[model samples]
Target: MFYTTIFVIVPPFFLWRKKMKTEHLLEFVNVSMAFDDRQLFQNFNLTVDSNEVVGLTGQSGSGKSTLLRIAVDLVTPQSGEVYALDRPVKDWDPRELRRNVILVLQESQMFPNTVRDNLTWGLKIHGESIDDEALLKILEEVQLSSLDLDDDAFNLSGGEKQRIAIARAMMMNPKALLLDEPTAALDTESAIAVEEVLDELIKTHQIGILIVTHNVEQARRFTSRVVDIHAGSG
Candidate 1:
């Protein structure tokens, strides 16, 4: 008699982690970048690991935001390298790189569409889809559960917009998230609300987060490590 058998397989992460270095999710090695006629940073190095929150704090124009931009290939360094998930950022296509290492800037963009459309737009660009159940779950995770999917997304306050920006990044199932002063514009109450959502994200997920904040206290509050940018604030 012959016996029948089946094989089942499961992958832990979308990106291949076999060759990853000690759970490192994002890395900058000997990188150098500069603004017009003014050098911003040189020979800088940093890392963000899985299930970790790394903070960057410094005065304005200290190249903190520039580091976040370089991670996803938005701004390429004149020297050295930036890696995401063990692969050089230059090796990944721009859209694909941005998806894996999501960047949520201070003044996040809001489309004229509804909240549902704003949430799904990134996936649509990638030719992907998420059901209503999943969308609702992400909303709750970002502490915007009170928001209606069909509501005008442009009407949200600064804090709400920042959280939605994070939700938009979360929609991509990113391995790393880069935040440039995510709570800079919000009131104390608003900032705390956003931080609550971030605390939950850290508690429940294996992703890495790098936040740029002028407030060292805020950074210390949420991040596993806080890095102070020394580049002269231009």
Candidate 2:
């Protein structure tokens, strides 16, 4: 009786482990998209695993930002499929999907309110109560722990505002973060600071990250693997 139970439990446990090992956090399979008369992408394929950071680099209008949007379901491909957490994107609830796969845009959009208000906005929208501890942790993770909760969010500098925006997304506890030129607008020092925070977040949270950057050096420094999009590629 004991041997039979052990065999049944151990076999299923190993199978589950194998399944997890084989699945990606986000995947795009043979994706194709076009805008107006321009074909931006054709049969593009990419995968992001939970343990690695992937960078997208290309010239302007190469569809790097569009790819990130597709991962978050903000944009639909003309053909092919996007998978998140081993399931098709269509199978996810939109709100839940956004929470799990947060996208941080290049420009920081702030509410005309206090930092506390902006931080809690997503939680309120998702019907979850604000946890002060979690909020503080996220702030620290994004290198903005010095700012008071009641401080005016719109009064910060461009780089500070960017950090705050990243903190807001981190508050949601996403499984993956899709960043569109996260450090593009910042000065050298500020950009380096933000990159440090991003590196720490990936290590500490064990979440996958896909970053789109026009700077080849930045892409090489920040990500484990880089994907270059071209005009004619299948």
Candidate 3:
């Protein structure tokens, strides 16, 4: 009888450890979506492993960005389920969920204040206590050291603004990041800079990322897995 119990318990522990060691960080089970009765998707499944970069690609209006919104819980699906960090999204509190799952929209909004305020906004909203040193580190990571803390974000370049947006998402130490056309407005240099920072973050912090972009090269450059969305199940 003791041997039987031991065998059963040991296998379960080993399985748990195996799961923990792997990334399988985010999952979607038969996800579907619709807007105003227009069907966007049906029975779609996707999984993102930790430190894995996934690219979401499709033609214009193919619901690529909408898919990320659903994953981040900014929008609800008509059917199916989304789980982040292995927990049902609905089971987690909304405020706490926002902290864990950060999303950068196609057009990021900057507060009418200093660069410091914009970077710290999400952290403060999530009740995270961070010091100046930590803030500086994150800003430097995203190559925004040139922007003074007191300087108005209103005047920053498009690339600088986007980098700041990325920094805000990173400050939360999130399990995953949802990026929608993060570099759409940047020059070549700035776009490369943003991509480099993202690559560094993936290697150093093991943060899982789902980026929405129409640029096939960007998708090829960053993502380990590619999810292609086509028109009407094509």
Candidate 4:
């Protein structure tokens, strides 16, 4: 009788452990946030997992961007829990956490240096380096072979800068990538090029993606699941 009880209890316990290990890369549980007099969302639930692309869509003030901010601790929610890499968001250092889970904004921020410095800066943050050959390959992947590594990053157009920002994030090899209107500023050809790179990341690295897009067609094409924050439920 004792052995039978032990066998039944042990299997379920181990199964629970396995389930926990597969938790979302970033998860918002009953999260709530507000700014000034406006309430952004309540009881919001979202899960971003490895090997999956999740789309986030809503109107301008629906707080889609804020959800991304909260994941990396940029903005704190008034209430609810946030988990990153299966641990509570507060458990990890903000900078270290951001390194593993990177966010690329719509409007890119340029470093005051050459494009080489911009791309290498990602590796430098982790005390690693990439040679010129590999750097050029990454550039070519993003359709910027024409731009020299020595070219000033600040001089690039808004759309070009966006691509650079994405390439920079790729250098870091984050476990999860949050992109906010990533291709909004690009032309049709450039947009498709960026999508190809993202698809590669998904297939090769099993990286989770949380993409916030206004274009319904883009959400359908890029994501396996879509969540509207205003609807306020999974």
Candidate 5:
């Protein structure tokens, strides 16, 4: 008689816990936001470790993207505090803070220039220099190794543009990435490609990701922990 052995696979959370660093890359304490009479978040608190993927989900106006913006200091809460790298968001230099906690929006904008130009634009502004070999390595990570540097950014599809934007942010070696609907604009194929890249990034680089996605299925697949603004309030 032959016996069958079945293996049970562990969830991503267990693996993530093993790899996570002690310190949180970002944190929100008693956060509250309102637009005039409308209240978005009240007494909201969350923390993102240095090596974890957190998914944010909610309805259309539930402050998912707004939360990410708060991390990067793009939007200030009416009350409460946000911290990055253990320092208060308001205390850090805006340019320096953005370098460490970069935000990549859904509709990523690309300069009407060569792909290489767009990739290096941030570095140029920050006065950082990298060789072609280093540059090409990052391109390969984003699955754009085959594209010519001279290729026009405007010619690429929406997915390609998003990937380029992500690659640009990666060049800064951020501690945490704030993604607002990263794959929302992509087709199935493109979305899958980007997802694969994100998986590798988390596994290899141990970069923390706070992603705001409306697709619950995608959130389940991508994140170890999911936070719903509405649910959390109750």
Candidate 6:
């Protein structure tokens, strides 16, 4: 009887350890990156669970944006690994990975189309047409309630354009949002609007957010946790 109990308990314990070892929302151990001769980060490590917002801040040349790109698999690190959703980022299909972990950038580029079309572009590309109410709800979530449905996206202001870009990204309902300097070029009002929208999206959708910014004060307003990076020192 003693031997039987011992066999069962030990096997289960070992199996549980194995499963935990392979399970993580996102993880990077001893990650490093370089561009030409300049080192971006060395032995940098990060781990984030689902639905958590992570704020990253650093100096202009400290590679904060580059780190965001690396997290989403857009930029490969010279050495080290990136994992998303418990799998190596490189092992996942690019399209699938993108759908799962979407990146929102600072630059805004809109196709010459109606605001509706631009906002619903992601759904259309994914072989699904937008549900009118759903699209409108997303637009509203980003506080683009004033965006006329029939208006051309290209005619919008820079802040409007950025909001539209965010709407497009949200159309996929991704698990993680990796934002790279999203509010850098916007005015104070617009920047506040974007931050508010981001906060709402994360809370309502339960999506993890990682924002890379140079403004420490701005980061403090939105995220509960902040990671400050220094080049070559991780």
Best lDDT goes to which candidate?
4
Rank order by TM-score, top first?
Answer: 2, 5, 1, 3, 4, 6
Q: In candidate 4, which residue pairs get closer than 3 Å at backbone N, Cα or C atoms, i.e. clash?
A: none
TM-score of each: 0.87, 0.88, 0.87, 0.86, 0.87, 0.86
Clashes of each: 0, 0, 0, 0, 0, 0
In TM-score terms, candidate 2 sits at: 0.88
Alpha-carbon runs more than 4 Å astray in model 3: 1-23, 231-234
Clashing pairs in 2: none
lDDT of 5 by residue, 1-234 (tens): 123222233456666666454457988888888888999878888888766888888889988888888888989999998899877999999999999999999989998699888888888889988777777888899999988888999999998898899888998888899999989988878887888888887777788998988887787777889888766531
- What tens-digit string does per-residue lDDT give for candidate 1 at 1-234? 123222222254423455543656888888888877788777778878888888887667868888888888888887887888878999998998988888888788887688899899899998988898999999999988999999899999888888888888889888888988888888878888888888788677778899888876787678888876663221
Instruction: Compose the digit string of candidate 6's lDDT tens values, residues 1-234.
Output: 999999989998998888777665667767887899998778777776666777777777878878777877889988888898878899999888898888888877897689988877777777888667887898899998877788988888888888888888888988888888888899888888888888888788888888787776787787768877753221
Candidate 6 clash pair list: none
Most TM-score-accurate candidate: 2
Which lDDT value does model 2 have at 213?
82
In the range 1-234, model 2's lDDT, one tens digit per residue, is 999999989999998998788888898888888998898888888889886888887878878899888888888888988999988898899999999999988888998699988888888898888767877878888888898888999999888888888888888888998989988998878888888888898889888998888877787678898887653221
Query: Could you tell which candidate, 3 or 5, scores higher by TM-score?
Result: 5
Q: Is candidate 4 or candidate 6 better by TM-score?
A: 4
Ten contiguous residues with the weakest lDDT in model 2: 225-234
For residues 1-234, could you state the per-residue lDDT of candidate 3 as single tens digits? Answer: 999999989999998888777545678788888899787777777788778888877777767788887876888988888898877788888877878888898668899798889888987776767788888898889878776778899888888888888888888888788898888777768878889998888887888888888777787777787887542221
Provide the overall lDDT of each model, using Cα atoms, as 2-decimal numbers: 0.82, 0.85, 0.80, 0.87, 0.84, 0.81
- lDDT by residue for model 4 over 30-55, one digit each (tens)? 99989988998889998888988888
Clashing pairs in 5: none
Which parts of model 6 have CA positions greater than 4 angstroms off?
1-24, 231-234
Q: Which has the higher TM-score value, candidate number 2 or candidate number 3?
A: 2
